[model samples]
Every structure is written in structure tokens, then in C-alpha cells.
Target: MDHQGVPSDALDPASPDPAQWPVGRLLSSAARRVERDWNAHLATWDLNHASHAVLAHLLRSPMSQRELATASSVTEQTMSRVLTRMERSGYVTRAPHDDDRRRHVITITDAGRSAFFVASDRELAASMVTRGLTPEQAEQLRRLLVVVAGERGPEDDPDLSAGSAG
Candidate 1:
């Protein structure tokens, strides 16, 4: 048994060697581990995966909360809660749209931009999760994941908003 009281074999019972693991199991395990580690690191910055998504999406440009929720793959209510926290932290501001009084736009504050960039570097880097993989291998993994995730191209993904390009 290990320090956590889990049997040594149980620690990786699904596959003693990763090479022997099924693709589904391997992918699921890798994703869970990466998300756990990423979330832990993000907590140090007073953020989480969800908030990081919001900031990442906003990095492109200001957009309405509803649009942000869609782009971030979060519910509107959840996005509202996140925005409330971000606004309270001075990381974002919500203002009524000039032409659409019923609509509000979210803008990342200067502080938000700084926090996003800092956290973004750590959040987006695969190095934390792909510790043993070479750069070429990492690239190959990215390509494979894209296919498995059903992404045809960046244009098809709102999360990869083109507004950031310019």
C-alpha cells in the first residue's frame, strides 16, 4: 500500500505500462491528471478552469455575457457568477452596450489582462502534462487530440475566436 492507503498495483491497475493501456483509458486518465494539476496551479492565482476559460475567450475582444457563456461552454448563470467574482476582484467590468441598452458587454481590465497572461502561460502549456514527450511528440499528440475532439478547424470553433488574431 502507498501513503494514500491505495495498493501499489491499484495505483495503476488499469495498465502497468502505459503502452498497454487502451486509447480511451489512456486519454481519460491523461485528461483527469492534467485538469487536476492545472486546477491546482490555477487556484494559486485565485482562478479555476472556468474562470480561465472566460479570460482566455475575452483575450480576443469584449463580448456579451451570453456570447462569453457560449464561447466558454458554460451556462449563462455560471458565466454570470464568474463575471460577478471577476468584477469584484477588479479583473473585469460589465457595462451596458452603447447601442443595446438591454445588453451588457464584458471587458477585461488591465489587471485582468495581466492576470490572464500570467495564468494563461501556465494553463495553456502542455509541458506540465507532457513532461516526458519531446516537442515533436507533443505536436503529434495535439494533432491527434484535435481529431479525437472533432475539431475540423479553428474557424469552426467559437472558442478560438478570430478577433484575437488582429
Candidate 2:
């Protein structure tokens, strides 16, 4: 038993006979581990997955706070908090919309783009999640995860419907 009083490998996907574990345990544990590692990697740029997504979106074009929130699938309040941190880091700037005083447009800065590009290093990010799998197995896992994620998510979301490209 681990410190939590549960068998250490009970939720480990790499464990022998992990197939016997409940799907919820396996998925949650795996997600937690991967997120932890990914967060650590992103820390070098003082960014996280959420910030990365924001940078990605802004890279395409500047958008209002509400629009960013909607695109990010987060609430306006949540997006405000993220923007606040980003603003502090000089990664993004907020300015009043010309047409609407209540709306603030978000634009990524040069630093943000630089951080996003380096932090978006595909090889490092891919390895963090697919460390144990062969290239073919990793591809299969990505497809499977897309299916799982798409199951109950907004079907029209481009991020989901676009499908993985090699």
C-alpha cells in the first residue's frame, strides 16, 4: 500500500494488469501525472496549459475578454484572473475596445509569442506525455484520447473536430 493506503500501482496505467483497474481510476491518475509533468515543463516560461491556450488564441488575433473566455471554455471571471496573471508577466495587454468601454481586447506581446513558441516545442511536449509509448503506440493513444475527449464535449469545437494531423 502507498501512503494513501491504496496499492501503489492500482491506478498506474503501466502496471501489470492495469486493464483490471476501473477506468475512472486509470484515467484520473494518468491525467494527474501528465498534467503535473506538463505544468513543470511550462513553468520554465512561467506559463501553464491555460496560459498557453490563451497565447495560442491571441496569436491568431486579438479578441475581447468575453470572446477569449468563450473560446477558452472558461468563465469571464476565470479569464479575468488568467489575464491578470498574464498582464503581470508582460505576456499580454488589455485595452478598452473602441466600440465598447466595457470590453477589453487581449493581445499577446512579443515576449508571450516567444515564450509560447519555445514552450510549444512539440518534441518536448510530446515526449512528456508519450514517454513510455513507441511512436505508433503514441499515435494510437492520441486518437483514442481524442475520441474520449470528444465524446461529451461540444461537437462543433474545432479543437476536437479537426482531428489529429501527423
Question: Each prediction's TM-score against the native?
Answer: 0.72, 0.78
List candidate 2 segments past 4 Å from native: 1-19, 152-166
Error of 2 at 81 (Å): 0.9
In candidate 2, which residue pairs clash? none
Residue-level lDDT tens digits of model 2 in 92-148: 999999998988889999999999999998988889889989998898788668768
Q: Which ten contiguous residues of candidate 2 have the minimum total lDDT? A: 157-166
| Candidate 1 residue-wise lDDT, 48-140, digit = tens | 788888888888999999999999888999999999988988888999999999999999989888887888774366777778988887776
Model 1, position 35: C-alpha lDDT score = 85
Local accuracy by lDDT, each model: 0.80, 0.85
